[model samples]
Target: MKALISNKVFRIVAFADLLQQSAIWIRNISLLFYVMEQTNGDPVAVSLLNVLEYTPIFLFSFIGGAFADRWNPKRTMITGDLLSAISIGVILLFVLAGSWQAVFAATVVSAIVSQFSQPSSAVMFKRHVPGELLAPAISISQGIMSLFIIVGPVVGTLIYSTLGLVYSLAAMIGLFLAAVLVQLTLPPSPRPPERRAVPILEDVKAGFRYIRGKRNLIVIAITFACIGLGSGLIQPLDIFIVTERLQLHKESVQWFHALSGAGMLVGGAAAAFLGQKLNPRVVIFVGIAFLSCSIIVEALSVWVYLTAAMRFSVGVMTAFMQIVLGAIMMKLVEEAYIGRVNGAITPLLMAGTLAGTAMAGPLMKTFTLVPVYGMSATIILIAAFASLSMKLGGNAANTERSAVHLD
Candidate 1:
């Protein structure tokens, strides 16, 4: 029962995250639309914009992770959030002045600013929350932000379209500023200890060695990679399916995403309330299996509503997977190496996302949306098999070591 309630520090952190996420969702969608509008809906321009957005995640995630470990995570978050706000402001000013170069540069910088906080946020969760509660906490946190994701873009877009671009930019800045304030109120995380005995390169090498020493770590990394791949494809492809394939209206596209978010939110809430009793791995597997089933049905369904229902199921499953994977990550990795582990894991996921997105565009060429997305179900089934077949108990050494420490 005590686990249900977060400390003041955690509450502030959570609130800050919710705000950050809301702003990020609105910002990403707005930027994409803004770029498309500026280019007069050229596909090349849209693709380039995507490249700019995702490139930082691929390149600097490791560096950012290292920075998070080197500095105070809370301070890092505040700095990153502030940078993000500044980036948007710059873009807004440029757009108002009709400077395309400025707009493009600002958009590119925004991705870098956003990526900086990724590691710090994970570090904070590791520090403030107990391992047992980490999954549920993350699930809850994600759920709240996701719910905003369901509505923020649509409303922000409406405001942007009707009220003007400046208003949309202002709204994004306001949300980021709010997030910064909330983060400021949270208790500061103590900085990670510097390892004087080893240089940075050696430290990175040591982190790699540590992972190599554990088999479960490898599986976990691979699993996360697959998850990322699935997400990148799922998002853009699902939109394509809903609007282009199913003959849904432009406004209706938002509802499909909203339904998916709603399902994930419900699943997350349930995990937050009851995740302590469930095995983390089991939860992830169940999610994969459920998504597999949903994908199959979605492929065959002639109606748009059925696709929405499938998206909702996938969301629920993703929530469970998130809870379990997050907890395991916190539990298994050492404090010194969490940053590196995260750094390594994140890029694989990024690569996977890239792979998924890249393939999604072309795959639709060979087949209809139904059969193509339906194929994702097979991938999920593979994930379920992988999850069950892999042994998480490979870290018995650490478990034994901890037990010995107690004795």
Candidate 2:
């Protein structure tokens, strides 16, 4: 991990990512609490927030990927941070004016810009990181993200509760500006070579065709989509679980996120240590299976401490799954196609997320939290079993070796 961090580019990008993720989580948590307060804990409003947050991915990720391939990644990242800062600045104005509705618009705009920024970030990893160190790099990155996940909610809630919405928005604006400054330190990344003139839609279609031809990529993408669905179903319900089921105040919700983040920290450390030794396929399968079981236990248990422990366990397994799957995808695709391949898979994942969020309100209204959690667990379990058939683990080491050789 130290060796990977020693690389100047990786260090810069990782730090920038940490700040960016922190800003995102802080904004999300604050907005969620604010909305809950305004709507008097209406489930429908919460679900709508989730939808608005993720809908831009469905709408623009493919176009973002196409452009990421065409543009210099460094410039793309800088521009994204700039745009995000401006958007937050606008929101700050609205908040100062006492208009809360603008917060939702800010969320949508942030998500849209993220579609471009995320692919560019991915491209940067592919461009700068050595193939041999990729897994560890990703693990290290995830570890930092987990750290933010632990702290961001607590900090966000504190700021929102004490300083109020305007101050929180100002903090977010500052974070985005910091990210942009850090991004400027990165060396310029190469742009893809010009090809014979072709329509952008055709380029996107070709990307899909490329993925469709690869069965392993298809299986992995589908499994991830399922995981996204399960995640979506449960994510919006966490607040309800704490406030309604556990009989805790809304402010106490950060404890659950903090505990989960603690687990992620542990899981990420383990992945960084063992990522190269572990079979990627097996890691993903076992992670999902354990996560499924944990979700089930969490759903059935009403005790706050016990449920918190289960949520922690879920976080650990989730870290393992995410780190391993990311490494596998990076190894599987050629650098040139990384953007498009990621673009192709994002919608399937976001579609599942959108569907689950759309269903969460009605499901909770009709049946309550247990059934919703139960449904999430069941879907994740199915995804776990289905992972057994994937060829991800087989020849993974050899593939890495080949990738290094190609580089």
**What C-alpha lDDT values do all the predictions have?**
0.72, 0.83
**Taking the tens digit of each residue's C-alpha lDDT, what string does model 2 give over 226-330?**
988987898778888888778889988878888889999888888888988977778888999998888777777779889888878878888877888888788
Which lDDT tens digits does candidate 1 get at residues 214-242? 66677777776766676556656766666
Off by over 4 Å in 2: 30-48, 94-100, 236-253, 302-305, 361-372, 393-407
TM-score of each: 0.88, 0.87
In model 1, pairs of residues that clash are none
Rate residue 379 of model 1 by lDDT. Answer: 66
Best by lDDT: 2
The clash tally of candidate 2 reads: 0
Which ten-residue region of model 2 has the weakest summed lDDT?
A: 398-407
